[model samples]
Target: MSITPQSPASPAPYGAWASPISAALVAAGATPLSSLALGPDGDLYWLAGRASEAGRQTLQRRHGARTDEVTPLPLNVRTRVHEYGGGAYAVHGDTVYFSHFADNRLYCRGGDAEAAPFTAPGRQRFADFVVDAARQRLIAVREQHPDDPASHAQPANALCAVGLPGSAAAGAETVLASGHDFYSSPRLSPDGRMLAWLTWDHPRMPWQGTELWLAAVLEGGTLGTPLCIAGGPQESICQPEWAPDGRLYFVSDRSGFWNLYRHRDAGGPADAICPMEAEFGSPHWTFGNAMYGFASAQEIVCTYIDKGVSRLARLDIAGGRLAAIATPYEEIRELRVGRGRGAGFLALLGGSPTIPLELARIDLSSGELEVLAHSIADTPDLGYLSVPQSISYPSASGRTAHAFFYPPANQDMQAPEDSKPPVIVISHGGPTSMTVNTLKLATQFWTSRGFGVLDVNYGGSTGFGRAYRDALQGQWAIVDVEDCIAGAQYLVQHGMADGERLIIRGGSAGGLTTLCALTFHDVFKLGASYYGVSDLKGLDQDSHKFESHYNEYLIAPAPHADALYQARSPINHTDRLARPMIFFQGLDDKVVPPQQSESMVQALKRRGVPVAYVALEGEGHGFRKAENIIRTLEAELYFYQRMFGLPTAGAHAAVEIHNL
Candidate 1:
């Protein structure tokens, strides 16, 4: 579907802005894309998964053309059955090396057409791996579970190697490095003489701080003493790749925004090839990859967000000239540059409004783009989808906050002539994240059903730049909650929503904002939190490896964690939570344990406050299964309908609403 250029005179509402809305919707629940790797036969491979029933997730191989052909590997092959699976995968000839669930066992897929486990069920946990076809070994980041109490909080992740396409007991895996809290993105140098990877420790997210390490590959296929080549306390390294030349390249957030940086050797500092004020690196919550790719060793093509719009830009590494590559789309995600066979291949989303995500191959020589794959089958007709408009509001501290406002679009279901539609204020997760202008089916689900959505970027979101991202550093619960409240107030003051019927909803971190907003403020009369962090202390203790220390920055350090944790935890302030609330949680959630929600639910029940809690038995941090997604969506909708005395959409599932 093609979008007609929207004129400035006919500016769309914040939610109706085509580009930002579509991008935001697309990014809302996008999984971290595994790094794009080209197979020996030139076939591209990446990890793909979807939300599953009870939030028990599944990750499978997604090849070109056969996107629907998902091969579910054994969930218990490596990690626990309940844990999320599939990180980075490497395909060498007929064999595949990838991470499995729980035990983090490295699995090999080969032989019969059916996928059978090659590695023993209980073994090593692998992060990212590279197939050294010439050496006939798999170079991977192996993580060892810690034993001691203080160290139990930190796992031992190191670079290791093992014989591949062979017996699991053939050779003992050799650890190349140790003492690191986390390890990832192990890339073998082109000449096979060196290796590069990223590592960082406690209290720092990859975006906050990380270091890139490089080492020489020894004659026996082991790594020499690893050296800190680039990255430090102030910079966060992401997606480190070795160029065709011997030089190593990566993305760093040294200059406020994540930009491309290259290093010639392990001695000197990394040079920034492309620098900008927008984020080039997303949070490494999942394993795929991010950033611009090397078109040649000297030229790189990447997607960069500038002023909230994603654009494709070409950078001359040698000359330092950054130029925009014009496309018909306003936003682009998952960029991969493939050379050698043709001009190069890049995966991007083009156009606006009803246009879906399409993979495009760019001809480096001719500067032309060819459509490779389209995500949506049937494109909506013109005027069917509402375009989002960018709106800025003065936040509490006077900083201008960003949000996309979607007007009530379904013509058949207009609001009462005298009153505006009720507004649903959406707070995106990451409090460090931003809302984009991408078309999404989920948002459409609400708008099509007659709700106006105001997706707030709030104070700490990324797209606005570094200062904005750091705004929530110590003010986590406070700033994010206020921004969401301000967003709802903005809608009411603008005559775009009925102030009395305002509702707020968010999941995960967004869910935390939803809960905090409801408890600390009186703006929202009704709210819903999906697997949100109710107790900050519980989150610090129960979260997995990546985010265990995240609260140090969001709230406070460990010993002092109790005071801040108690004060910020919504469960402790049930007396102030007079508004009706609905919560959805995964019983298997390690990020924010089930007890977090259970405590809140029980407290609200005892206090005689209206509340509903639905727990998915086998789920984790987030709901994945299609049935669960549909069920949660419908349940929340039904809860709202009942609370507001609106027309019922049939008899929904009986949720135990407390104090009803």
Candidate 2:
């Protein structure tokens, strides 16, 4: 629910307007919710972040009308596989298996008993589990890290089966499939006679290319000779699952768009199921990413992204006909069908422009939605929220880029007559990922303070067709930076923002874009980087095994990468950066280490350019602690107010702006 929209009552300077949407509220209210799953007994389960517990992740379950925490305090249900872990836990019947983040070991819990470690404490981490009831094991993707922390060798990833109690290999992991640089989605057949999984080698991210393999589960529990069913070095395949009738189904990008396809183990050509110019699959950044799931033998419940927005539909597997399921959500993160009496229900994590990310159960028969968990408990007034407008603007070479434009929205206040609001251009990370118009309190934090924002989808972002996604191939900084610049220019040209006060900010990969725009262009007068990349060589050298070779596709192969790295790195061109900027970095971030931010701060300081740096201890990659989030937001707002010469309305701890 929201307050009715109302006209402004008084005038206020942009970036200085006071609002009830404070930084503290944004941190406390924006609780992270993800990893939606359905239990065998019609129960709903999902992972929720406990910000107060130093950003610990806890598993929560809802049976009937009662909701309770499954993993209590001090027990963080998370995995470190690939550094950006997902699919950390899975449930079957009354049993649950999950990876304990602290020790990187697998734990099991059954019925009402306390969780206990099943796997020996070692350097191995497990994720993406599928229970093999017939075999008494759980098939999962295992990453074996080197015992010596100083070792330069990368962790070995493979498809391994962990034996449950009373099995021959009980309390041990037996390798089922190996020899691949990375592996995920270890799905077993309904009858447990066959297995299917995805694998990709170095220099190719899962989105760039992946191979789907199928093999017979031999009598001795070892996999027989495996055969490649689909995908290649040029084609990307995702989420391979066995249908109820034993036919294998998966998503492939051979059509320039990720679409559904089915293959029979009986040896026949794969058939495209409902081919369309939409994305039925996403980049396999983490494990267990399911865009579609089996609802019945003939019916499939799925979600696809078309032009940066998500749509829910029921696909007839036999006829290849898709029937749209009407829902308020503009973005659906994950979807899964229930079992037994709850088979008619679909569990998902979805959100819209008005709704925060939440765990929901939707009934196919009645189209009724039941809210299971909310990312945010309290909602802000409608007048304080800024609704985004999906927009596309012209960029270099007659090409177009997409973005979501948010205007300054405050019912109690408006800019003085005829004054345009200052705009913050945002570049999302993943360079491979796309941004949706979900109700994010972080974005609203700026809008409620009279600051307009432009969230750029940029070139190479997903949700668009493969062509648009491939636009940044080998043009990472150039293409992504251009789109952000063009978006800000478009906003200014349309009178939606003040050109003189343009700002750009992004984290991780987007941080590189922000730095590039501030270094190479004169459009943005101010900028912010949250754990941004300042040097490509530094990123490639320090990045984990998952993204170590990502630059080869984003920039070039190793033979040519050195030259491009030297030429395009923002740290190499800081002399051209004369604008005021602020940086936030996590000291423990192995993805984008603190050195990236420190070097840039020193460079700007020596040149007498206004700069501020905030290094957070006990944090990594992205900020998770509530205190750090609140501090960074307040510091950034203060930095912008001071740099833009706006009057500070509320009490904000002053940030030391070097050379200000």
Candidate 3:
């Protein structure tokens, strides 16, 4: 046999230049971090790679210490990659239940576990779940596609339940209650006799307004008539939890800031357990849990944000006093409190002057903090990574905004003796989401390659409070675009980046900002949008049940929507775009639809501007396949290099640049 010499993987030109270096680099599909639930036997249950080849939604069980004691829950298989709806997993007794997104069915693992589809998939999209083991039923929020004309105005959603260990055709699903446009936080009473959940309707996101409902479970496992326990049109309630003592506890924003409220009986008014001007529930935008667990019926432990700082707080329900359990950390991503156990774990990020996001575990009672993990990088001997400096920039309306700036640094690339490197301004999606000092390999990817990065927490972003988040009301495209422009200008004025080489990139709502910025302003010379919204009106009409009416606040009400939608949509104004841009979209995306990107690409082509468009099939809203991610990053790097007249050292696709 002839031995063939293996070719080496191509190395990055600016090797070892990345800052806040780590050993654990982000794999193509690797998430920065995730939360896990501990099983009754102390086995850890977490979602690993199982749903798709690009990403796995496996229910992993880790036994014993650091040895090879980890075993995935039986019946791990690739389901759907995007919009499968099921991600969060819950444990009841020895059985493990999780949502199967691909089939829109629920599955269980334990005792002769054969992964069979439980609930029928199509009529509704299933989300976060609560298992009533004794009752052999599962309570979940069902987001159903609308059916009638009025349904189009307000999408249909309801708190529903289904029998576990049953067949999909068995018709096991029971509608607990209806009239909810969106529903979440389903909690079953410890005795399995009562159910408590949260719901909010159209023209309002969950954070803006929500109601808490409690219902008795009938003998046949159907829900009795729901009683509105707490909240109204102006109030927002979240994370409804049933204490072991039969008391219903939830977080409410009744006092302008989110605080904890408890309802002892079916007809009683909710009593404020923890009251403060700090937020207990984060802005209801992302699909992750915020407040993890309740310690006791009276003592509550949760995460709260005050003035952009995330802290762990312990609430004394009887005294109405809140104590800061853990000192402020850089960011608290997830918190989990164990039942009857004073000791709980927290997934924390401590941003340092030299590190990006350092993951640590916090013990509530002892107040002991331990570093559990840190990101690792492949390169070595790189100069210490510079920490992001949090700064504020003035918006177009003269209001100060927040952002984090990471100066350019790389071990190999020394700026031509005197020239400052280029800068990349990033806008986070959700228009409601905020960028934190969390560890993100994508940011390092640019910075490590000799580029400065500005992660902007523009107006309408959360973590600062509601008023700040509501600032983007009726000003989505304008406020977001102005903030990005102002942030880049601030960097240029302060000599942080080369003004002539400024670039901007964003995804989803952030992508809208990117398109609007490039079209409305001449500051950025290059831009990239990932599965972004190009037509605001298109979104209002075609979006999913969860966000069907989101544009009502972001833009304007539906009756007067045509003019405002056209004005805010970048697709309509593509004729004014002069900067070189790249676009990425998922064919299966139901939120923004592929037409959003296609329209923009066609408009730019007609306008004779330089633009490149790439669409990934079998994906939705976001790219998940490893090959697609790698290709996107590589293509983007090449696009930037060619646009900026930088030296290309390797073979890359000859992309067709329109109107260049």
Candidate 4:
């Protein structure tokens, strides 16, 4: 539901207008959605972050008309296993097993008992969990950190099983599989005879390549030689699952796009179930991402990405016929296919340009939609919303970059008659993850205030074919920076934005891109980086084991990487930074820690470039606290207004610029 559209009485300066969309409103409405699990008897389970609770993730379930919390306070149901952890919890009947963020220990709840630890409180962390019902244990990807904090930078990863006792296993865990740099998607066959999981080595992220291995579930919770069923160094596989008939099914990108494949017999080559140009899987940034599953033996429910938009469909395994399921969602994050009322259907964590995060169930044959949970409780007036346009433009080095463009939209006001809106070029954090079309209040907050936004899927982003994604290899800063510049230039030339007031912003990997752009080029007048990377050398040393050697692929291998570090790092070349910029950093961020942003700010402050810095306490790589989010948003708005010489009437933040 949206508010009725109305026009204002007169025009005002682009950055000085009175907006109905406030920073607090944006922070309060920006509730993100993640991981979903379904139970038998048509029960719905999912994770929701409360804004008032400082964005603490709570696991909630719906059984019949009753919806209640499964995870109580003081017990944050989250995993630190890859930092951006997903698949943090799973349910088996009325019992639930989850990872406690505070201790990095496994806990078990439900069955009329309070949640208690089942795994020891140590550096060992677990995620991507599945219940091994026959053995009464949990199979998960465990990251074993060294007892010494100094060596904690490197941890050994493996597929291990934890007993389901209500207390710590007394430092006991069965090592089911090991020697892989990373592992995910541990699934068991319906008969519980076979176990399947995906693993990939370092230097090759999960999206670059992975192997699907299957072995017999022997006695003592493990055993049997595992055979490589599908995928290799050249192919990337994701979400290995078992069909009702016990056939191994997974997603593979052998055809340049992630698509569905199935292995019918043991030691036999996997066959493509449905071949298409669209992608059936996304980059493995987080654990427990499922794009498709078995609706029945002959039918499969799935979601595919084409031109940066997601589509849901049903595929007939026998005839190879695919039927599109109509829905308003352009992005489907997590999905589950199970029996509801004894009928097969699909449930998806979905959203659109005008809708917030929603849990929807669609009947397989009827395509009927029933939305179960809305992340944002309040229904915003739709008149002020800016619908995203799927756009692509010619990029540097004769390549193409995709983006979602949202024009300035406001129901109560408009810009001057001849004034073009200021464009904000947003670079998504994942140099590997693609930008999807989902409604975000943070993005809407700017657009509804007469600002255009271009969220770029640069060369290194996923969702496009492998070739386009690989183009970023050995050209991390080069290709990404070029695509961002080209996007702003295109919009300016098309009269969609004012070239003088163009702004660029990004966080994490995107933060590095933003710093690089401001250092080497002068396309935009202002820039902002949220816990951004300013030094390439520091990033490699500060990153986790999952991405310890990622620089080898993004820039260059070591020995040669030393030279690229100096050449690409913005911190080393602050002498070239002339544009005004503001930086937001989390003091506790392990990835791209405080020193990275602090060094850049110190250099820019002394070099006569107008710069402001805001550091928050108890914050991580991304802002989870409501007050910090509100502070950063308000501070950024104030910085932009101050830089543009606009009168700040209701601005709440007062930042000090050393060289303004």
Q: Write the per-residue lDDT of candidate 4 for residues 386-414, one digit (tens) a residue.
A: 89988899998789888999998766776
Candidates' C-alpha lDDT? 0.70, 0.90, 0.70, 0.85
Best by lDDT: 2
**Which run of 10 residues does model 3 get worst, by summed lDDT?**
1-10
Please give, for residues 1-660, the per-residue lDDT of candidate 3 as tens digits. 111223322233332232333212334324333445656643445544522355544554545343121324443332321133433557766667666555555666664555556666565556677877666677776666545545554435677777777534243777787776677778788898888887777778877788888788888777788888788877877777777678877887777777777786745567877667777887655443656466777677777776666777777778977777655465775666655345554444454333434445566668787654443323223342445888987878778888999876555455455577788999999888888875466666677677789999898888777777788988899888888899999999998888989999999999999989998889999999999988888887788656777888888887887898888788888778889899989998977899889998988888788899888888777776666666677677777877887764246644556777
TM-score of model 4 relative to the true fold? 0.97
Cα deviation of 5, candidate 3, in Å = 26
Candidate 1 has its poorest 10 consecutive residues by lDDT at 12-21
Question: Which is superior by TM-score, 1 or 4?
Answer: 4
Q: Model 2 segments beyond 4 Å from truth?
A: 1-8, 166-168, 649-651
lDDT of 3 at 654: 48
Best candidate according to TM-score: 2
- Count clashing pairs, candidate 4: 4
